[model samples]
Target: MADLLHSVYVADKGLIFKVSGYSQNLHLVVDLVTREMRAASGRVDRHMFEAVREVRARSYHNVLLKPHKLSQDVRMNVLIEPYISVRDKVSLIQNITLEELQDFTDRFLDKLYLQILMQGNIAWTDAIKISENVLKNIKWEGLPEAESPVIKVHQLPLGDRKLRVMSLNPASTNSIVTNYYQGEVATVNDTATLEVLMMLMEEPVFDVLRTKEQLGYSVFNLVRYTFGVNGFTITVNTQRDKFTVSHVDRRVESFLKKFSKDMNRLSDKGLAAVKQSLIQLKHTTDYELKEEANRNWREITSCEYKFQRLLIEAEAIDKVKMSDIRKWVADHFAVGNKSRFRKLSIQVVGHLPNSADNATQGESGVQDHSLQLLHAGQPSTNIQENQEEFITSIDDFKKSLPLVNTPRVELAQC
Candidate 1:
């Protein structure tokens, strides 16, 4: 049983059941899984407490990582996903009985919208046979296509907002600051522009933030699409001993200000070179069948169904003008354009004597084109008490902000 059962895991999106063995043992593995799913015995096992402790430890470690902690906060507050924090999980699990667990599992499995992906040397007919056996054993009602649950992300409000939370690891001296620039509704063209911008900013950002400025060892950027609503983020993991979270946040803004200027100096030939490189990257061949299958499965899961996204994006990149990139930066990031842009800043401040500075004191820094370049990352060491700009209550802040109503992806007509 141990050899045949690979693992069972759960994430924010969904649960996954995995098994592995020889092709001859495939039926046996499926049968074992089906029986387990069908049996909902409301019997408590004392031995399972050890496993619970392990899970709790892992969750604790996950939240301890500043970046992961910041991401969880953003999803819960900005995206409005009801995520269970590590502390909450511990309390909930302690009070939960086996009967409650069994009831919850039964209710969860009562109706299902199953998505299966089969790879390797399995034939189509054999795959269908395996799927049928599992479905028959489960004996669950399939959810209607229209009624299937879709992941929804709340639209961030226009203008700048900041969420500053103390870091989970009190012993650790490192802090993380992430500034997310939310774009308009998701489109292939806009996504392509973001990809190009991030790529261009990648080397320069590392050079300026980590190498030259010495902010932190880990400084990077990401292109994020929450439930297909486009956005991008720039993050810095700096130590509170050297600088406060407020200072790091300001420096991040300062980098964007400098990067914006660099974009204007960019010539047509330079932009073309970057575009061509991106095109070549898109056309790169998959190393194996698994890679291709995983790519397609991602599309299926997201409901994007854009299997040829890479090629489509490549074409869009070819059409992208230097003006498009410049305008995108200016529209979303330029100072004095607060009414037009929507920005969310998440700061996970570490526990240290110097780390307790006001997270929202540097609103004026965004407009300052020239500052002490050497000492700019260092905010006044004097700890401020008042921080009205910081989002103290997430619920109150979100009450007035409008949600982004992104249109659903329609299935292609046959």
Candidate 2:
């Protein structure tokens, strides 16, 4: 008889498999190996192939035609190492034959280890029986576990800045600009600090850039953690008919520079209030059953199995002083700290009446002056003088920053 195994051990180190649901509900994820082995047995027919092609084509078109998706793709390409897109996947799908996919799936499947996770109301015996029943149908011969993929986290080089303008929807008048600041590798403490800082900055950023300056309709500031790397971004979605990307960039910089002064004035009482609000939010027992499971699943998937991470963060937040928050802001946004500051700016420009001419005018009038101030290497009376200088070319931007040796995520071999 096939083995019906159930073993309990601490997952000290390894890749994660996540399952989310209520305690009474069962969730099963057939590992890639088993799924691919089944696929390799030639289950895919011509109809399935055509269906997949059509689905992928539609997805590619949606991404291409949607301005928000296009802007998100630009942001991801800038942030992710060895950037690959849905378009690239679609291209690959179009180029490969069904037989090729089967072969490739077989080879790739041979290189992956299997993981099984049971949560909620499932009993150990039930899990064992389920696993056994699933495996009984597959051709796997209890092969030894294969290695896991290595996911490399990309680090933005210090002092280097990148600017990308992706044009999408030539007929749409709306444009978007996103500025990303490369932050330190995430730790519980640092992540907590950044979260509080974002809370402090969010309203002011919007009030100044959106309401007061009238730069755009949508203005947002938030902390973003990609893989294990932490960063913060300020995004504005405006109309090319009214404003250009350069103008938005300038206004954002101006707000941030002045915000530094505001940071200094953030009284102990103000800091305390923010911390209390965050603590209250974290301590709120508002998790539904599924929400709780999903939160645990995220912890497992991120390899930070502190199921009570919010509590841990709350404790960290308690110890965070106003000085700590100021230091973090200074380290990231301070002028002349070239070795510690890096930014990536992505602009999605829309088509409108003489938009190209307006964009040039904006760039020359705003960006040229800013660049000149940066090149002068002298303190300027302007509030935006401390902003990171933008580089037009990706290659030049990469050259200015130090690269981290984070391992690239790759398929592992058996």
Candidate 3:
């Protein structure tokens, strides 16, 4: 345990250091994180350029070829802050000076609020001692205390907004399309319900889109909760040679339309089966010691102190009436309820010339065809006329239609 107190430093923007170990080794973990944080605050300029350059290189690769990164960019653009590209991020890091790095560390520390969570085989007294010692060693004395940074998530306007981004790497044929359905601010119950909904939707979505429809190799339904905002996203990663981004989007919408009806027609026995499966899953003690520690850390960092959130959600699942599920589906996915539900479509298209209209706008001076598609009402000149024609022809071929209401289903009375 004495040797375990070796310092670890992370040069990320939000957190300078994080230490996790078994609860029995709490003293060592606390000393390690505290020592690292203090050392980081004092040595901000040490290896700063190398650290930034390495991270920047990694980020650039992540943005170019990573499908998840593309999906995340769209989700963040619609639900929170617009995402800065890896290129932009790298450029920003390159311009930052050593003094700027030091200043950032100083300011960040001045306003830092330490959150600590101790669970499993640890006494409350020892936890308190650990906390006190960590704070004492961090040397936060005489510094102006700062509140945690307020997370202000952006609200999506009612109706649909489609954004098409061209991948910077033109050589890659893989394209990603993500549709985000924005809903109300998240509550514990709502989050739990959505989790179950995600579980229910995941397999079917994969089976239909990936297996049956052969839309893509990777297809998923993800429940996204950022700060207080909550939503679900359906994404497909496919190639332009096989299907256009617009074609993939339509297929996803088609699946949702069919899924709504299926949800309504779900028999009582079937619904109960799903619920039971989720409950059993929640009750399953499958997590290792390290996984449990990480879960606790996640809850603490997110300021969601419901350490037993899984159990709480399992209980909530039992209380979920079929009507609740139906209503939620109707509210979020049922078309024509545009006021209550907002959907954002993001397409990361590939470089096939046939599908060039949907090709992502490059950082360099490549003409962006989707610009006209997004701004359909704007007039165009001869040069712009050719671009508009290219976009409209693709739009017509794709049968770009407005979202229509899903036919209401009649469920048997419970």
* RMSD for each of the candidates: 7.8, 9.0, 8.9
Off by over 4 Å in 3: 1-13, 21-33, 36-48, 51-55, 81-87, 120-126, 141-147, 334-339, 353-414
lDDT of 1: 0.72
Q: After superposition, how far is residue 373 of candidate 2 from its true place, in Å?
A: 24
* Model 2 bad stretches (over 4 Å): 1-41, 132-147, 334-339, 353-414
Q: Residue-wise lDDT of candidate 2 within 1-414, one digit each (tens)?
A: 322222222232333434444433332334433344455448879789878777866567556545567767766655655556554654565666777777865664344344455665778987887677556545444434344433444567655354545453445777788888878778888888899999999899999988998888889998988777788999998986787677777778788889888888889999999999999999989556656766776665555566788899899998889888888878888453445676776766666765453343332311111111122112112333323554455545444445455433222410
Candidate with better TM-score, 1 vs 3: 1
Index of the highest-lDDT prediction: 1
Model 1 misplaced stretches (Cα beyond 4 Å)? 1-5, 18-28, 40-44, 65-71, 74-76, 82-87, 144-147, 336-339, 353-388, 410-414
Reference-based TM-score, model 2: 0.77
* lDDT values, one for every candidate: 0.72, 0.65, 0.64
* TM-score of every prediction relative to native: 0.84, 0.77, 0.76
Tell me which residue pairs clash in candidate 1.
none
**Which of the two candidates, 1 or 2, achieves a greater lDDT against the reference?**
1
Judged by TM-score, which candidate is best? 1
True lDDT of residue 233, candidate 1: 86
